[model samples]
Target chain A: MVSELSPTPGARSVSADTEGPRPPMPVKMVIAGGFGVGKTTTVGAISEIEPLTTEASITSVAAGIDDLSHTPEKMTTTVAMDFGCVTLDPTLKLYLFGTPGQERFGFMWDDLVEGALGGLVIVDTRRLDDCYAAVDYFEHREIPFAVAVNAFDGKVEHDLNDVRWALDVGDHVPLTVFDARERGSVRDALLVVLEHALATAQQ
Target chain B: MTVGGGVTKAGTTREVKGEDEMTAGEPSAADDAWGVEHPPSIVRPFLLTAGRIAGGDSLVPTIPIETQVVATDLGLATLDAFVFDQHRDIITICRQPQSLAEIAAKLRMHLNVIRVLADDLRADGQLALYAPQAESARDATVLRRVIDGLRAIPDSRGAIRER
Candidate 1:
């Protein structure tokens, strides 16, 4: 004989177990750009903590094994990233992660983006193509993101419109120029990313 | 049938076969070789803890639950919504059952601080203590499953699902 065991109508499933309220964790954002575009500086400016950086000296053994041409002048490399925190409100916190500014470190991007709210793509006007790798990565991943042009000294100058045209950024994407070293500018760039993330999440 | 050991056919009696007689000795032989022994019984116990932390507030412990410990223990930290915009480093390290002094030494934290956190975690049900060595294996399996589930969730920007 077939025995059928079924719950009565309107019976709640055991899956609805977590009904109580809990405090939320802070949101996370990543600062990404090409080599020496000021991703670390931007994160350090706004971070409340003594920015934790995992920079181990590139040893001679790693000289032949790893590519050091783009990173020769640098004494320390962000093997993982630099982490810092900022309080946005009484109930929310924002965590900033500065990713290594080289295309070869693309493998680490996926882990950095996990659970992150979104990112600010820091670009330098001198080398517009420098930001292309990050842009492409974010686009392919369908991650909500915004681009901020870092105005480096003696760098090639370009207006926001020209930069947008060169990057071929779509109309929905937000683009702006800012001094990465300034706190207010960095905060504004972050706000743009968060706003975009919120808008996209709503959609 | 003849008395003692004999087989009887209809209207006739004869000596029993050697095979039938040998079969009767098997039970005696088994009893002589090994006496009966009962299997050992074991019992296991465990505890579970959970807690919540408000923005700018320290982690607060909740009530603890007692149950059968299943495997090795695990610790996890979940960030709040407000802090999601900022980046922070969070690392979890496990300490085997030990005194507050030992734990502090291993983690390089002050003894008093470790005690405070441990007590809070224990009360909140976030920290779990298991009993009976067998439970360790089970706990390891459960912790692995939990980690796998967390990793399976998509974490990219704009990938968060609405409540």
Candidate 2:
């Protein structure tokens, strides 16, 4: 009865892996809005690389919602978040995460917004409701954010002030209009959120 | 601002603007790789992780999709140090620093699957994670660096950009 021998004799002396070309520091900001509010488009316009989707599937909810019948019933839907990275410098990387703003996906936001710098809530004037979840989430958490009304075809259905009033945000939130398709427009929109962050941090 | 709810809707946004020009759907892709019919993916994570996948655990300490992981040379040298094939596969992919999302995409597995597996190796000190800032209050210094990075982008649009 010979015992199973070790795969490698005394090969587990793993050394410290902290030398040379350390992995760059990663910082993230979320681009959140309801489906079709141009979260991915906003990421693509300014991302150095194409946006990538990570389908983080959640299986089964807490009791009452969890059906004990079948595997299909127990397994929940896949929560995908598209993200893109910008190499800020050799030592730093900034990630732009396009997250779903639907209420069903709220469970994942705590993890998503953790350590986030801020957020940008993209709005569609015709369907302001699409972005309301995003606006409320950021506000409730007091996470600095800016709301940008994405003017489809360069036309805003509602006036800027009207949208602001409808959102009922304080003077602190920066609300603006930007085109999701234009690279420069998206950049400016992000800057607006960062400006809010800077102001918040300075206080 | 996401409102709270108990409804359990799922599926990442149906599309990511214009990305992932893959030839086909995920279910079929896994089948093709195996060269044999495979069961639905809803069950694969359970089988692969022996029911220890990230979301399945109430306290697995999940990392963000953007978190970068790389293989330590010692882990690479002692390949058998890893317990499962997934661990080895992840270390192979991490020779060059890769985000969890990239590794998941490359392996054609769900992101949470990779999260748990990678974290296992990371916990063993077989891999190093260059993590984002922990859940904490946003700091002015980081925000200032982010602003500077955004400004560094070559203004592709016209001149006289508004500040």
lDDT for each of the candidates?
A: 0.43, 0.65
Return the top candidate by TM-score: 2
| Candidate 2 chain B: worst-modelled 10 consecutive residues by lDDT | B29-38
Q: Name the lDDT of candidate 1.
A: 0.43
TM agreement with the true structure for every prediction: 0.45, 0.75
Clashes of 1: 40
In model 2, the runs with Cα more than 4 Å from the true position are A1-16, A57-76, A103-108, B1-43, B55-57, B79-85, B135-137, B158-163
Clash totals for all models, in order?
40, 7
Q: Residue-wise lDDT of candidate 2 within B1-163, one digit each (tens)?
A: 1112221222322211112322222322111111222233343343454444454333556676767778887658767755456677888888877777778766666676677677767656677666655432366777777788787776565553544
Q: What share of the true interface contacts does each candidate keep?
A: 0.00, 0.31
Model 2 error, position B96 (Å): 1.9
